[model samples]
Each structure stands twice: as C-alpha cells, then as structure tokens.
Target: MSSVPLSFEQLGSYSPMDFLTPHYRQQLHASLQYLQRPAGTLLLHKGERSLAQYYLLSGKVAVDAGPARQTFEGGSPQAHMPLNGSQPNPATVKALTDVSLFAVEHQLLERLLGWSQEAAYQVSSLGGMVEEQADEDWLARLLGTPLFGRLAPSHLHALLARFDYVEVEAGQRVVSYGEPGEHFYVIKRGRASISLPSAYSEQPALTLGEGEFFGEEALISGAVRSASVTMLEAGELARLHREDFVELVRPTLIPQISRNELARLSQQGSRKYLLLDVRLALEYRLGHQPESLNLPVANLRTHADSLDRDTSYVVTPEGGIRSELAVHLLNQLGFDAYLLGEQPPLAA
Candidate 1:
C-alpha cells in the first residue's frame, strides 16, 4: 500500500464515491491514494489483468474493447474493475489532460470489503448503480426505440447486463451507410440522429431523438447499415455488440416477427414476381426470404443483368435507410419494384 494519505478536502467539489453509500464512502477513504495523470494518457486497455480498482478523482479516461469504445470524463471518482480471465497487461494509459486518481489494488479492496460489513454494503450499493448506468447507456443509443413504458424490472435488468458502454461527442458519425453493421446502440445521455442520401432529390433525410434505436434489422441479420447515424449531443451510450446480441437478445426477439408477415412475402413467390432481398451479403446468409435473391442495394445496378426486366420485383431491406433507397434505385433502373413492409420512410 502506498503511504500517501487521502484527505476529504482533496476530493474537491466532486463526491468521493458518487455510487457509494455514506458508510462505504468512509471506509474507502481510509485505503486510497490520490495520484495525478497528464493528458493523452491511457488508464487501461482491453483484456488487461486485474489490478487495483481505480477511483477517478478528476479528468477523463477512455475504455476501448472490441466494438464497444467509450471515453468517460472522470468528473467524480469512478471505480475500475478488471474482468476475470487470462489477463493481458494494459496496452496503454496515455492521459488526455491532467488527471487525478485514487488507486487501490484489487486484493486490498477484496480484503477490506471482506473484513468490514459497512464496506461491503457500500460496495454492493455502488455496484447496483454501476449496473443501472449500463442500462441507461444502452437505451440512449437506439434509433427507432420501442415503447419502454411497460418494461418490467427483471426484464430491464437482463437487458442492462448485456450492454457495453460507449461515449461520443456531438457531430461524430457513429454509423455510416453502406458499411457493415456490427453493433446496435442506445443513448444514455445526449442525442443523435439518422442521415440518408436522398434518391429522388438532392435533399438528405434526417431524424433525431433519445431512446430511439437505429440498425435493429442489421443487428439481427448481419447486414450493412442502411443509413448513417451521427451524434447530435455529446454524451455517453451503451451498445450491444453482435456476439452478445445473438446469445442474449436474438432468441427472445426472433419469435416476435409475425408468421403472417412471413407468409405474405412467401405467397408472392412466382416467375412474374421476384423477391429481391436488399440486405447485404452477410445478412442475406444469416436468414432471408427463401426464394429471394441476395442482391445488396449497393450492388443492384451492377447485378442488373441477373434479373429479368419483365419480372415484378419486391424490395425488402432490414429497416430505415436501405429499403427506401432500394425502392428508389430499382425504379430508376426501370424495374417495377415496391417495398414489402410498412416502416418509417427512409431518412431524407
């Protein structure tokens, strides 16, 4: 343990442990060291071995792992807990600016909490708050949000655990159209909007809000993004990457697609009426209309020869940007094409 003693005065205007109870806060203060870090520094990296649980005193830190990357402003002290596994040392801890931190080794924390009931209670409470934060973060990134008015606590808790936190500033493009969609996002704080290139005219389509989630279709089907999503407000977000999504959320969601909708599209299968799945190649492989040809909207023009001009085509894309754009594209090519399902108009 470092000999540097902690003073309540040094905690500045920020709460010592915003996530902890008063009793636990007192316990934590007894066993922490306050250290300062400079800008452009990395505090931790993905797949690092467990170390001390760091409580940020001041400044900011970025946590990057796989498809979930976020930067957190350590306005108040926040704890850092390493995941259990084959621990790789951190890749970097470069500072973004001058930073102040309170460090406590993991073993020391376990021992302290193990010995003190008050400490344990406080830590547990803090843990609950951390978990809540994760949920809020996830909901904020969605583009077309479901009505969450009736979600149960148990259901909400299950959803929260699967999300990874992301942070972005205003004017940043989170997802771009014509790129592979790998994850879905929900906002925790701030705001974002969807943007699409206009086909009929030069005007672009745009929509903005919190709680709304875009890219739901791509997330399920492994398709390319149908539109671009950009942050309109600077804040935090929670994301569910593709792997976690498939294991945790997909099974529950797949059953919700009505059988009637499936049959309606299937009934259209014939020589005169062709099903053109406008989803990307990877998405088409995941699952699609059995009789539909996998011609992604981007490559539709190039692959025009594959389709007969006399055939009436049905354009079906996952959601938002892709389907509408596809309908417009096929029309430009002089194919009698119509979108299959009812949904929000393509972003302007």
Candidate 2:
C-alpha cells in the first residue's frame, strides 16, 4: 500500500464533499490516508465496525452483501461516495482490480462539513456585508475551535444569533476582578490584557487577540471574576448574555455526573476514570479525594495540552465552581471531561 495527498480536483465530484468550503477541502488533504491495494484484497468485512470513511480513488471495487454483489468503478456515480456509510458495515468490500483509495476519520469529516455549512449560513445571513467578509479569518478560527466544532449546527447558529457586537476603547475595563460574571466575550477585532490581583502570586498577565474568548471561567463557575480584562487597543467584541450562554453553550459543552453515579462507575471494572481536583496545591495538600490528581484552575489552560485526551476525567468538586470551570476548560480543549456534581468529604 502507498499514501498520497488528496487534491481538490480528486474530490470535486463527491456528494456532500462538494458542499464543503474550499478552505476545509484543502484542510482534508492532511487528514486523509491514501492507500493502494492489489486485486482481491479484502478492504472491509461484513459486520465490522469502521471509524473512517473510505472512498475509492483509482480503480474498481466489489461490494458484496449476502447473495447480492455490485461492481463500482472509480469516477462512477456509485463510487463518488463512501464504500459503506453504515456502522458495523452491512457489506463486505474487496478490490476488483489494483485500486487506490483514501480514508478520513468519520468524526473529523463531519465536524469540517458542519463548520463549512454553518459558516456559509452565517455569512449569507448577514447579506454578505463587507465587514463580514473582512472578518472571515476570525470567523473561521472561531468555527474551527474545539468547543465550537463540537456544537451541533443548530445550536451554533442560535449561539451566533444571540451574540451582540460591542466596541471598546483602549484601556477600557471589559471585566473587573471580583465582579459578578455577566457576559462571555470573544475578541473580534483587537487585543485585550488579563491582569491578576496583587494578592495572588505575581504570574505574568495574559494577552488575548481576535478569535480568542474570555469570561467563560467566571461564567462556568458562577463566581466573581478572578482577573480583570482590559482593552489593550480599540477593538470589537462579540458578547453573549449570561442567560443565553448558560442556556445554549454551557449545557452543550460541559457534561456532568453525580457522586453516586461516579461511585457506580468505580464499581465497574471495565473502565477506569481519572479524578482531577482543580484546587490550589495547599488546598490539595490539606485534603483531596483519594487517588485524585490536582491541577489548579488558574494553571489549567497553561498545562492543558499535556493532558491525555484518551483518559476520561471527572473534575472533583471543591467549591463546585472550580470543578465546573475545570470541566468547561477541559471540554473546550477537546478532552473527555465530566464535572462531578455534589462535593464529598476530602480524604485527610
């Protein structure tokens, strides 16, 4: 077998695929695995599960199901789509002749397609305003983000509609430390600075630019803002009201489990769950769940990349807000995370 990069021309005739935006079509080139197989090679067996979508590229293939069989030629209408679209593939597929094919992860393709459709609708909904065209880069960035990518198209569209655009001048305070969280903000045109209070360790401040978001930490936790966010320069922001955020975004992104449910999970030997306590090191030293890992909420984003996405994480409840915030951040970063509801006594 061999591998080859997919070109736009090669995918132009495929259904649904043709609907994807040019940018996403290009992005698919890197994710698709191209392969070559000799005649009579069995590519897929009946009743087997497949996580990828396979497309015939350059030869004929035979699809057999029970006593019926069909021959599909490359470039033909039948071959333009995936060899098998159902789970536990109902048919067996084999090469009728030396063949070349490409496969893309099912979930990844679905996400790109959803993003493309949603973005197209968003731009067209604005009547193709010049400003919308100009902000296409930021829009694409927002859509490609893990959090946004996972949202259903309908929910994403609703969230987009609820956002109110606002302008800020340099040095304007967008969110102040100790203030109740009200709205979630996404930078649309310029930059903002994040400053922690002096009482906290002097960690350097953070700067956020277009396509990046803030206020989620406070929103998820339902706590006072831990840091102040100020405009570094004149810029535009897309703000979602607290109510809209809680209703549309929060429930979709963060999954939750009760302490009793967690105990039930622990009883099952088939799956192992990781417990993460997002409290301060001192707090953790004093008391934490047995065998739980600790990584404070303040430092979560910085070290989030090092986490193992394959491991399911249950954020341990301390103040409840911190655990919720940690789970929100984990989900936003594409980790399999669940917030543990109800705080249990920490082990001494």
Candidate 3:
C-alpha cells in the first residue's frame, strides 16, 4: 500500500457500490476517509469478525485459507470485491505490496443501502402490504417527493395500502400510445424505455430505472398516452389506479414556494435552496431568476441525480404546466422541489 492519500471519488472503483442510490453514495462519500497502508500489514485475521468491508485499489494481498495461500492483485477485474466478506473471515490476509485500502463500516453501508427502511414498510395486517419483503423505503420515497411531502402521514400510509405489484418481463410493453391511462406505474426494479411512435421517434427517447415512475402525463392531463413504455429488463412494478391516484394524490402536489420564502431560504446559513428555471433555452436565455439553474423538464430526469440531496430546489416559472411537471418529477424522484411563484419580500 502506498502512503499517499486517496480521494472520495475513488469509491466508484469499489464493486457493489452501485447497490446504493446516488444520494446514498453521496452520503457515503462524505463519511469516507482516505487511507493507504503498506506491505506485511494484516488486512484481515482468520476467524475474526468483520465490522466493515475492505476494498483494495492498489497492490496485492495474499490470502491464507484452507490448505493453500492465494494472491489477489489490486487493479484486477475483481479487485473491488469485499475482502473477507464473511461476517467472520475464514481467511487471514496480508498485504504483499504497498496497498491502497478503504474500509466502510457495515452498519452505515447496510443502513444506507435501504435495509433499515424495510420495517417501516410493513403492515400490521396480512391483507394490506403486497410484499412484506418489498423495498422498505418505497412508500417513504414517494411521500418524501414534493407532492406528498406536506400530506398527513396517515393519509400517505393509507395511500400505500392501495398499491399493487406487477411483474414485467423484458420486451414487455407496459403501456402504449393512444391508450387511456388507467394506472400510474412506478418502477420497483429493472429498466424501461420510453418512446413516442406517433412523434416519429426512431429510438427510445427516455429510460427509467428503479424508483423512477411514468404514465403520469395521461393521468394528470386527462389525455391519451403520448408514448409507449417497454421493459428493458425483467423486473417488478408497482401501480396505482388512476382513480386512486387522483383521489389520494393530485391534492398533495400543492406545496408551493413564494418568491420571498425562497429568497429567504437562499439567504439562510444552514439551508441550501436553488432557484431552477425550467424553461426553453431561448426563453431562459432571455431572462430568468437571479442565480437560477436552467434544467428544462425535458432534460430533468437525465440530470436529476446530479443534484445534491442536501439542497432544496424551487422550480420556475410558476403555474406553467411545464414548470409544474418539472417540479413534480423532481420531487417524485426524491428531490426536495417546489413550484416557484413570487410574492413580495416579507417585512424584515
């Protein structure tokens, strides 16, 4: 191991890191400390319990397990696998060269991986929850979205009772153009391609993966479906009937930020708020909110994860369907977002 320092971005080199959501990864990166250790160091001792996972980014490690000693080289294809992943390591490992290692505590990593959220998703009775083993944060993630953020907890819990799970196979068509939207679908797992055949699109214009949702435009606009959704991978899905969506939802999407409240939040020392202008390039180029970032609704899903979870975004211009859609999409996708409108600054 080299004695040089490492950066948090290097965490991407670690395997299984993709199991974490972008927001969760950001949290882990913030908590991780850079480390480098040298040869002859005991990376793991045989039969010792592991409280954390170890990753090697450089150098070689010799493992003493069974009757033989095997060597693992850093920078190899599988170098990112957790070293001694078993709770009680069955092998003793020694550094063979100057090594770069990062240890992530199991507790924090598992918690951030959404395991802790599972218990919260359980139902007291057998009839309510579709799967007790479902993603624990599934409903919480929806409620955390801007639409339901202000909803009474009881109401959101009730809404959770209405969800149903559906398994989809790769190449399945989840929805089609010109169809009356009957349900709103949220991707529970797997990937899907979204494209509009009527629009003369030659390829999928958009794609959604886990925690992403679709079929809302028709539900919200009372219009026929504009696009077709096809599964890119076999996965589970959760759907809410349109009537349930309208009656239990729609109303919760009223969290709005007045111009002054936003400005005040932007000035607060602890709060980080951004004024987002979701207008066309030409319109935004003409004039926009001071210090606002321009991320059009058409491009929001692609760029949404790039946003830091610690910040709140106020999306403008207020009341435009485009802005409202952008706000809902951002909030629904786990961002702290609100429709932007202006009121005079409050009296100081």
Highest TM-score: give the candidate number. Answer: 2
Expressed as tens digits, the lDDT of each residue in 139-226 for candidate 2 is 7777666566556777777888888888889999999999999999988888999998897656777899888888987777788898
lDDT (10s digit) by residue, model 1, range 72-152: 665432323322212454333445667676665444344333323332332233233345544333432221122221223
Report every candidate's CA lDDT.
0.54, 0.78, 0.69
Q: How far is 232's C-alpha from truth in model 1 (Å)?
A: 1.5
How many Å off is the CA of 336 in candidate 1?
28
Q: Which scores higher on lDDT, 1 or 3?
A: 3
For candidate 3, the lDDT comes to 0.69
TM-score of 2: 0.67
Error of 1 at 268 (Å): 28
Put the candidates in TM-score order, highest first: 2, 3, 1
TM-score of each: 0.34, 0.67, 0.49
- lDDT (Cα, tens digit) per residue for candidate 3, span 1-348: 454544556666676666665655666676553356678877777876664677777889898987998888877876878876667777888889878877665645765555223324434421433455446445435433445445554555677688888989999999999999999998877889988775465544788877677887777767789789999999988899999998887666645767665654444223467878787877777766667777887888768669887777888663277777777777777676777666332211
Question: Which residue window of length 10 is worst by lDDT in model 3?
Answer: 117-126
lDDT of 3 at 43: 70
Identify the candidate with maximal lDDT.
2
Q: Candidate 1 vs candidate 2: which has greater TM-score?
A: 2
